[model samples]
Target chain A: MVGGGQLARMTHEAGIPLGIRFKLLSDTPQDSAAQVVNDVVVGDYRDLDTLREFARGCDVITFDHEHVPTEHLRALEADGIPVRPGPDALVHAHDKGVMRARLDAIGVPCPRHRIVSDPADAVAFAAEAGGFPVILKTVRGGYDGKGVWVVRSEDEAAEPFRAGVPVLAEEKVDFVRELAANVVRSPSGQAVSYPVVESQQVNGVCDTVIAPAPNLPEELAGQAQELALRIAEELGVVGHLAVELFETADGRILVNELAMRPHNSGHWTQDGAMTSQFANHVRAVLDLPLGDPRPRVKWTVMANVLGGDYPDMYQGYLHCMARDPQLKIHMYGKDVKPGRKVGHVNTYGDDLDDVRERARHAADYLRGTITE
Target chain B: MVGGGQLARMTHEAGIPLGIRFKLLSDTPQDSAAQVVNDVVVGDYRDLDTLREFARGCDVITFDHEHVPTEHLRALEADGIPVRPGPDALVHAHDKGVMRARLDAIGVPCPRHRIVSDPADAVAFAAEAGGFPVILKTVRGGYDGKGVWVVRSEDEAAEPFRAGVPVLAEEKVDFVRELAANVVRSPSGQAVSYPVVESQQVNGVCDTVIAPAPNLPEELAGQAQELALRIAEELGVVGHLAVELFETADGRILVNELAMRPHNSGHWTQDGAMTSQFANHVRAVLDLPLGDPRPRVKWTVMANVLGGDYPDMYQGYLHCMARDPQLKIHMYGKDVKPGRKVGHVNTYGDDLDDVRERARHAADYLRGTITE
Candidate 1:
């Protein structure tokens, strides 16, 4: 396992009962899961010797984060360490430039884009792709709404590009909603897709995800799932693949980005689906047969807990538990920061509205904006 | 945590993401979960000082097993540590005599029984309850299939009871099937009951559980659940309460026994119910509102991997995973022995028969009998 955040924490948790031991690699001594899992190798991911030591005695290597350099992964694989979804496939998820180029090559529809290494290139792309309010994104290592910005004027896009940052410029999409299509693929080429979810974003960070993408047409949902399935199979990824989608006003679905591991959008599956994305990720990487992706309930929703204003948002934990008895809160042991993905809550039932509202309410309570 | 075993292992696993710290009481440095959670205090449950050290700074005290003496638990409670369920309620589950007597006093119907400390008392009770074929059970410290005997003739029952064993002689139940009703109670008096499940016992040890008690009348299931709810409420238990039910040939439900924590019968809920029994137990003990007691699917079946002829069960784990993609196996970190509750596999789907067979097949495979 890599990273000691909640995702890794949950995976480690699930593996323990099955008698499958997991060793977590973390940078900080206080990494959430490391506090509980004793076999932790504490070191920065960028340190080659640290990574090498961490990979020792491991049958196969997997990750909780996609931040490791593709070259570093390649080095491990070259030394005969079995790294699932190998570096070549993982690069599409780690770097935006690589992802865009790969998706385009596969004829997957995406937002119009341009690679901008200089300020002039950004300005030129903005001029050609309809002037104001274009999006500028870093080519690598951005997550949780970070490393992306919007520019309304030519001057606004100049500094970021001129700083010698390799950026990607794309036409700002006027989509009706953001949908996430999640899938898991095994080393044996088997793949399964979860129902597309309608993701609600607040300030570029995901606030809530409603499974089955409420009110989405059957054909559109299938198309989105097919796109995710194609990516996982084509990339030969051996774990979860989360495809963020832009559901256009005209009902077309466009790919936004991809994550080659369990993604936040699939958190609802923890309580709602027959088998969770975390469990599937473990099986996929371990070369086990994939479990069913069909959900246990009719509707499921997941809401994230962003950084709260309080020092300890735990005060609401009790109230949230009391108010929404069915809500499943998964809090990541991390210092609360503005816009940080601290935790999430999952709620599922036949009533879509009830689940959605309950999930949001618990999330709001965690954020200290609402009280029971 | 009281003991560093599989239950504690999974609890620690669940607590990691929420940043909930636990102090495990271990007998050895590598007592399973202790191998993962290093923050364990090595000592026996019989030691008060060690217990105090483990209890201090803990948010809420719970257990991994019921072997901790009731007196020690009371002492912990006296010292202001919040021991869930408390001694007064836990005694019923810890001692069979106390449980039978308490159930009788509470007006819950059970088998005609009498406590015996000698051979004379057992012979008299058997004669009164219809001679011969009586069941002799030790009142305390019996689990799995141990410490129980079937006495067909008076002579067989005489010697065991003469040893001052403190036995219970009861009319053998002529039950059509055994069922388990699981309920969770909060400290604040709130409670929720899950659907009754039919338990399959092989040689006095539980081997399987079928959720919703297949084809059980709605009224009968509701009655069983109500009985469980009433018992949990009356007992003032602040956690899970698992009531084993004996469905007699005459279609009557009788209380067989009680367990004050997550039971094997409820394992199906992990992948089948609205809220997992473990999660609900956590919620109830923490005094949080109880989760819904709704089954997510139409059917769910759980089969135990008991101590059987299986010697190299680990070798079969891969095959089981590959064979049934929907089967969920939970193996405890214990050396498998004949008649031991080492692990379980749960499967759920729309078709009850298919799910049941899948669960049974996986369980048999783990037991070293992979016969088609």
Candidate 2:
């Protein structure tokens, strides 16, 4: 795997029982995945030579993140290195403009938007989208609300253009809430979809995810799953795909974003599903038969533990375990920086309200330790 | 961990999510835990200097197996390293005579037994404990039916004395079935118990396990759990303790064996319980609060995949996964040797028959590949 972040770390953990060698290509020795994996190459994923060196003796290459230069991936493919979610499919996840254009061509429901070459083009597109308060995003390199802006006027529009990357102007659709449809697809065209989940984001970073999206209309949930499956098939995605969606007040879902690897929305599966997303992602990448994606309980809620210096994480971990005997806490081995995701906690049971509350309390208690 | 076997491998995997560094001490680089852990020291665990080096910089030390020399553990403690299941608590697990004597003093239910000095002593023991066909076991270094024998006569009894180790003689109870009560205890006395499980042996090696032991009398199950918990507390066992028991024809359970780390009987907990034995073992060794040990499903069956050269494990893995998507396969990264345990599969559901069948089919299909 390329990029040694928490996703790679968790995925590697899932693969351990499969008895496979997980060779990680990390940018530094201190990277999250590098802290755990046995055979890790400390090299640059952006440099083609570094990537090629890392690919040696590896059966297939996957990712922890999608920031590797697309052209570098294509080069690896040229050398006959198998890259799941090949460069062509991964490009859709890398560039917002490319993703919107492809979704439009494929007849997928998406917000109104267009690639704007300059601030004036952005203003004109915003006028066509809605009058003001439009969402402007850089076509590439944006995550967790970075490189994204809500432009209320021409002056605000100019700020997005300064990013240098092409700007994609989008109508800020008034939606009831955010939802994510996570699916795993194999190179052999086999696929499995997890239940659609309600995602609550705090300042554009995922805060909590409730599996099966409480009280969601059955028909809409089915449609959402089907649409995400269709997107994976259309994009030729061969690993995990997380489709971010906007659930409008009118009971419809629209494509908002796409992540080509395991996403926070599917974190609940670690303790709640018949097979977790990380396990399925490993299976899918290896072109092995995927496991069941059905939820094992009536409800599962995962809440991110954003860093507050991770003050005495062991103390917080002890408190949570003592308080909630059934809670599943997953901490990434990272130098916890304030405002950055450091870990997550999962709670599941027959009662949705109780599960949600338990998850929230654990995450809050752990995060509160930092400030204390 | 002091030994790099599958128990350590799985325990280390559980520790990753807690963001704790797992350092392994293995006899070779190819040891199961060493193959996966990043900070692995390849050395002989029997060598005091090597063990001292491995224990340096480690906060707490635990075990994958009970074979580490008792004196070496004492030395580590003398050096200020916290040895969970400290030497005093671990000696009973390492020597059968010690275990029998300790249990006798504690009023634990066990078989008629004694330390036989020689074949003459064995004959005398057999005559006193219901005549011939008694069980003779070496006082130490025995596992998986090794160093144990059912001697029907004096000639058969002479074989056990040739090992040059003290022999323990006991009555061979006619049992209805085998069962195990697994529990975890922390340094602070916190403890949790998993449901009793039925264990089946093929050629004296554990072949299958069924959680909650089908058709078990509720009162008997509770008694078994209380017995195991009492054993853990009395012995000051600060990690997992698996009490192997025999259900006699008279409708009573008796202590058969004792294991100080993760045991085959508790493997079903990986996919069947709210908290896995490996996770609890990690938590206990670290003196962290124990998680709930309740079963999440109505039934769960685990079948061991013993090796016959492990013919194309990937093919068997694919077939099993495709056949039963809910099956959880855990393979210890070991070189396949005939009759050696390579991996195991777990299946769980509301139906006991279906769950057992699925688990058996997956394990059989994987095992059949070796012979084919």
- Residue A43 lDDT (model 1): 89
* Candidate 2: residue pairs that collide: none
Measured against the true structure, the TM-scores of the candidates, in listed sequence, are 0.94, 0.98
Docking quality tier of model 2: high
Interface RMSD of 1: 2.0
- In the range A91-187, model 2's lDDT, one tens digit per residue, is 9999989899999999999999988888788779878986888899998999999988988888878888876788888999999999999999999
True contacts kept of each: 0.61, 0.82
- Tell me the lDDT of candidate 2: 0.92
Worst 10 residues of 2 chain A by lDDT: A363-372
After superposition, which runs of candidate 2 have C-alpha atoms over 4 Å from their true positions? A369-372, B369-372
Report the Cα lDDT for candidate 1: 0.83
Best by lDDT: 2
Please give the TM-score for the first chain of candidate 2.
0.98
